[model samples]
Target: MRIPQIRLESTKAQIGLKTINAVNNIKQPKADLSIEQPKAELTIRTTPSKLTIDQTQARADVDLKSVVKRMEEFSQKGYQDLLAGIARRAQQGIELMKIENGGNPIATQAKQNSQKPMKEFGLGFIPSHGSVKISYEPARVDIEVAPNKPKIHVNVNKPIMEYEPGKVEVSLKQKNELNIDFEMIDIKA
Candidate 1:
């Protein structure tokens, strides 16, 4: 009996090589960040105004006019009474002269009717001015005020904006597949 054996072995092998090239369609996302500005406002207004005042003052014035008028009347009456007294004294002088003249009634009446006669040679003195009475009262003052007014006002305003974040997505794609295999043949003896 004879037998034969054949062993299959491989030292080196070169298989086919495959390369894949693919293009992905992608667009840049919209601008992620956003900004908002603050708001401010100012306003001013004004109006004209006016005022007035009245005042009165005096240095020498009577406080009670009615009382002053009464006093004037009294002074007039007193002046009349003093004049009557002077006339009575003159009449008494004339009567005394009549008695000194041995009761000469005609001459006494004539002297009393005539004005007083001045002596031609006698020492007599006459004043230039007569005495006068002075009268006065305290002063008075009064005051008053009136007017219109002033005011202030203020106003405000505001502005604003909203913001949002960006989004991202990820995925995979198949380009190619690689398959390699080996087989053994029949052996006999």
Candidate 2:
């Protein structure tokens, strides 16, 4: 049997309008077996103009959920390692605040008084809590296999602090399907 050609579909959306550009049979692989599939590397570029407020908020919620899921999936030691960097940053911020408010007896006394109440109430050292939601889609793969199994990798790049920048990447696997759909959300400045 002859190998089927691979098709590529690309789409771009700006300001709620979408433009699609596609090319097929761009390249052929050398290997031919019971299964034939194409692996793709996709790069999505986004800016503030392309994103809406609702979209950004939804994305952040998804990201936060993903983080929580990851924490649950990983071992305790691994989760601690993942949070160590964030903890260090928070500690630094607290230290800076302390320094800035130093040498004022009233402020010092207030801090002490506040801390005492917090400690008594067992609410001292509150941990940062939040959720991030992201928009993303799984990759599409079309192939023929005796025992069909497909692995899909979806990489998501997310922005932090609206104007500040960041990214998120997720890899997922699926089997026996050629059509996949997903969305990536970006926070605008």
Candidate 3:
């Protein structure tokens, strides 16, 4: 009689690994600023000088009143006195012609002869005097000045940063291969 044989077969599982790298990102923005400036101020003022003059004394140097009076005295000649004497003599002659006390003709003639010629004497004096004067005033000046300062302003913004946390992933791509097999065969006689 021949004996019978039995057979067995088996297979093992496999494992695989996959890797990924982490990534990081960062970003920042710039800051801002502002400024302003002003101009300066100034002022100035002035006054002019003045002068004055007077001339009262210089005008009275040459006067002519006394000279004119002396000239008039020479031109009249005594005509006034001659007329008076003639009238008196005529009166005495009329008295004599009237046969009154033999007429005092001789006495009248003597009185006329005794009388003085012309009237008024001496001349009047003229006036002349004084001097000149001058005066002056000084000038004045004033000045003022003021200065200005500039203004400045600034503003800064905080840096804006964006960050992504690093990430890592682990996965199996190909499983580790492991195989096992069992087999049995029958013999012939």
Candidate 4:
């Protein structure tokens, strides 16, 4: 007689993995600026001075009324004395005629002298000095100023960003295998 026996074989399964990392990117931009400047303004004004002079009384000081009055009073007394002398000479002439008519030839022939008027007169004039007036005014000045301000403007831009998602994949590298075998063997006969 012979005896039979059996045999079996087995293999384990294997796995593989693939992975990708996520990525993120960010960017920022600078801002823009603008400015404007304005100029200043100014204004000025001026006025001139004034002056006045008056000479009305200066001309009246040298007029005729004051000078003539003094002269007339001084000469009138001398004129009166001259008239009286003339009258006395006329009376003496009549007396001489009478003497001649009374038959006196020597009296009629005598030389006669007419009286001369006295010159005791004064003429003087003094003028009152004229007055003066003066007036003056100073100059004046005015000034004004105006200024303008500057204008400014600014502009800003938003930030830029980029993002990417992660990915994962899994696949089999080797399959599982199983084997079974049957064998007959005789131990004793």
Which predicted model would earn the best lDDT? 4
State in Å the error of residue 98, model 1: 1.8
- Per-residue lDDT for 1-189 in model 1, tens only? 333444455444344444443434444444444344333332333333333321111111222335566699689999998998799778777776668557776565677657665668955333212222333443443333333233333333333333343333333343344444444454555
The alpha-carbon deviation from the true structure for residue 143 of candidate 3, after best TM-score superposition, in angstroms, is 5.0
Cα-based lDDT for every prediction: 0.48, 0.47, 0.57, 0.70
TM-score of 1: 0.20
Candidate 1: stretches off by over 4 Å: 1-65, 101-189
Model 3 bad stretches (over 4 Å): 1-28, 49-144, 182-189
**Of the candidates numbered 1 and 4, which has the greater lDDT value?**
4
What lDDT tens digits, residue by residue, belong to model 3 across residues 1-189? Answer: 344444434344434434454444445555566666666676777787788765533333332235555466444545655676578678767765776656566766677668866897866433233344667787777777777776767676766555555555555554555454444554565
RMSD of each: 16.2, 55.1, 16.6, 15.1
Error of 4 at 102 (Å): 52
Clashing pairs in 4: none
lDDT tens readout by residue for model 2, 92-189: 56766677566665555456546734344444222223322434554554444344345555444443322323334333332333444444444454
- The TM-score measured for candidate 2 stands at 0.14
Off by over 4 Å in 2: 1-76, 103-189
Error of 1 at 132 (Å): 36
Where model 4 places Cα greater than 4 Å from the true spot, the runs are 1-8, 37-150, 182-189
TM-score of each: 0.20, 0.14, 0.36, 0.36
